[model samples]
Target: MAHRMTPPSRLLASVGLAAALAFGATACGDTSSDGPNGAADITIVTGFYPAQFLADSLLGDSGTNVDVVNLTPPGAEPHHLELTPDDVIRLAEADLVITLDGFQHAVDEAIEEARPAAVIDLAPAADLTTKAGSDGLDYHFWLDTTRYGRVASTLAERLTELIPAEADAIAANLATLLTTLDAVDTAYRDGLAACEQELIVTGHTAFGYLAQRYGLVERGIAGLEPEDEPSANALADLATLVNDNGVTTIFFETLTSPDIAKTLAAETGANTNVLDPIEGVSNDSRGGDYVAIMNSNLEALRAGLRCG
Candidate 1:
């Protein structure tokens, strides 16, 4: 179905608290103010960085054709994204909303309350798989370029269907995006093909998809969620793996605490390095966008893993 939004009750449901909004006016038959063929503007609300990147690429300089709002701000941790009432209303009023559910509980709750006309959950398109042989699905599928591309395809198709007037432009954008993703996949394949150490450990289990994709083994100090504290047993086991495998680097990510990884590195006589998960973008990020950050991560891996 083409995306449309009737003025939501303008009420945000937040853990038993409520914020109500009243819209004095509504656009005539369209949520977008104006665009191609006199079609209304399209608004897209993204859950986080990965979703925002795809939406930005899909729009592809279709300036004013579409507006994208990301709930998770740059430099903030997506795992702890706290949404304002205004954020919920934006989601409710957006023509389309794209997100990976369960990754952020607050965003998930907002989506349910906002009830956007069109919502694309990237999880299904991603075909999420478990990591470390655990029963829970790893939500960091974007770290795998192949999985990211699949979600991109889904978004392009949905957006085109929702806004036929912009289909041609969107298709062109998708082609370019697919090409970029393919190139990224190739780089990872070639970069990690051979390494001094295949046991790439990180601050968290965020790199399971990337490690699996490239046939590199990944172990994390934290569990799937960055905030999960590893038990003494888990830390000891990881230290053993580090020593036994002669691992030279202990990797940490941009958006989370580095103390644990740094501490482990000190304990194990390994160097601390960044292996970003690309969940959000900020000045501190090695690269400004997804592709650049992925390339930076590749360099980090190559250097840390001592890849030839």
Candidate 2:
């Protein structure tokens, strides 16, 4: 299940073609006019679901008109998302494009080629942490509530800058979202502090931020890519670690196949459960939106770790 890595030359050529297609599409379907409400024309393009959720929450029911579009489809793995011609056209027309850098290479390239009016990259604002033993930054900052709160506040300020007329509403929504984020942070702290075990075994390294936040150790069978398959030695070592740590659960994600997790669980005599990475929402998700899915993840952690 390894992802096909696009070489630098091919990627550049693809970006060039996408830009040309985008320009042609824009020429035919140009609609940059403002809405009839006299509201500023604000079009938000997000790379994935988490960014989409944050942008939507920040612009909650405001009188100022805003159109937020998420490029990644529901239930799709976003790491290697290929941009469609229409998606490139949308990016080219965006007033503001929001993305987490390094999470989706296609979106990063599209934004570079499209050159939208404004771009808000959450990676730098979130002060993201890097995975241990890996030079790559952990792009999953939303897994840590405190870091995500910072990102949310930064997003609010950016939105205010973009649409000054809706500053008050954006500030109010920011306050509410911040409060909820704080509560989530507190819950993770309080719930995980008393856990009997602090070891988390997952199918991939998506939970590095979460494990770091909660002071737990994460043993990932694969790296950042969810579709990657672990080698035989890696699986054997993970099985041994699970038994040594007395781990009772092996965690899988919603967007990936559970077969590997089940196989590891069988080898280790442990049960398996879904510990979503919140990459995208799907019909299989325990709950909708970021908060609900995060709460569900907390519950899974508590149960898997035997928290008091």
Candidate 3:
């Protein structure tokens, strides 16, 4: 069984928000008529699209006051983006701040110092995430549907607690969201189950959790981060695996350059295609909702893996 890590509530008091209901207060606001901002809420900060999209789906149109803003601009790599002094100010007053840790060291520091009302640190294993190379825990947890479900439940419970009056609405929304995600999860299982191959070759090790959940092998051309290149031995092993297993597709991520995946595919006589790590959305994608993105992922896996 995978061990689940829960955030320590007391750790959030540094940001001047009550730890008991920080998520509801910061992200959804307090629903009490006497509560500051009268509970019809807004969201000010988020590190990526998946969490924000989940939050909006949970909050729904009834919570129109809720706003989701991407702290990292479109096409910007989260690991390397620097938050300016102005960005700090914007986050300070934010109701909710969702972020992946370590990669955005600057943002992590700001959160530790600023302590926005409710902060959702997406990197459960922040201590394990590394810039050293691709061999560490990748912070892209939403790529795995199972982990995404856990995260969504935590978000929903917190949002429900914060806005008790809207609990029914939030629960309804969350149920719908979970149902949609479950369908996608089922699709991945059913589709990948009949694949001609079980190995997933990719540019970065972003699909580690996905592979784990689905019982497939993930071979990356580079490390956890896109910028890191594979060792010559790693390349040789990948080539051997492709030839031996008859792996067809070399999957490159949407967020980074695919020069390496393409080259590997060329050398191995395998086809190359795009698989979304979904750190952020590009202009070409319709929008970065978790369902849409994951559906796209399903299609890619079907085509790339020759799913039956």
Candidate 4:
């Protein structure tokens, strides 16, 4: 899928906002309204789309009386996301704040400042691997369906603690979500087992966990940060690896620039396709939600790897 890069000026603005938020310049405001049926008003503030999706699923529709808000806007990159003043206030007054800590500096600072009633950091909930050449934890564990299911189960348990009266409902929703996730896991394991090739060349290291889960090798041109530019030598090395591995496609993500992938593909005579990290939704996303997009990713991998 074609995606326009976040403009330089917009990125700069986001950085500026992050700086301002770090200094506590943003003013706090009121929290969300009370919950339905006289339950405690549960305001869930998430750092990005995946957490938000999980919260929404667990909480059910608006009738569930939980307010779910994702700090990262739709179609925006979750990394380096800037928290608006309104977001700061919401975080301050939220009942539960869920995030993949270390993924975004702005969100980390906001959570520290806000100090909500309860916080669930998905990074610790799920087993995390370190990015290559970096000591920091990889915060994109949600890409692996099984690991994501673990996180969801943990989140449901936490939500039950927050709202004891709704524990049964929360548990039921979690079971449904887990069943779907298991299906995805089965599909991935079965589909990738007999692939023609196990080497995946991606634009970034976001898929490390996914690759690890399914016993595939991932050669990421860039590190954890999608916007990081590749060195000339690194690009040349990636091109050589792609050609040596007989990689049919170079995978790019939905939110990052595909220029590097295109460049390497052009040099290696390979094609380019999207392997969504599902960090956030986009206007041109292959699927509307996590399950749909994941299925699409499965099909892409089957085709790209020549699975039998």
Better structure of 1 and 4 per lDDT = 1
The per-candidate count of clashes, in order, stands at 1, 0, 3, 0
Model 1 per-residue lDDT at 144: 92
Per-residue lDDT tens digits of candidate 1, residues 20-40? 223312323443433445643
For 93-190, candidate 2 gives per-residue lDDT tens digits of: 67799988888888888877766668998988788777898877778888888888889999999999999999999999999998999998899899
lDDT of 3 by residue, 141-198 (tens): 7877777877888877776665677788888888888888789899998888888878
Of the pair 2 and 3, which is ahead by lDDT? 2
| Candidate scoring better on TM-score of 1 and 4 | 1
Candidate 1 runs further than 4 Å off = 1-40
Per-candidate alpha-carbon RMSD to the true structure:
4.6, 6.4, 8.8, 8.1
Residue 306 lDDT in candidate 1: 97
> lDDT of all the models against the reference?
0.82, 0.82, 0.71, 0.80
**Which segments of model 4 are wrong by more than 4 Å?**
1-40, 61-63, 132-134
**For each candidate, what TM-score against the reference?**
0.88, 0.88, 0.79, 0.86
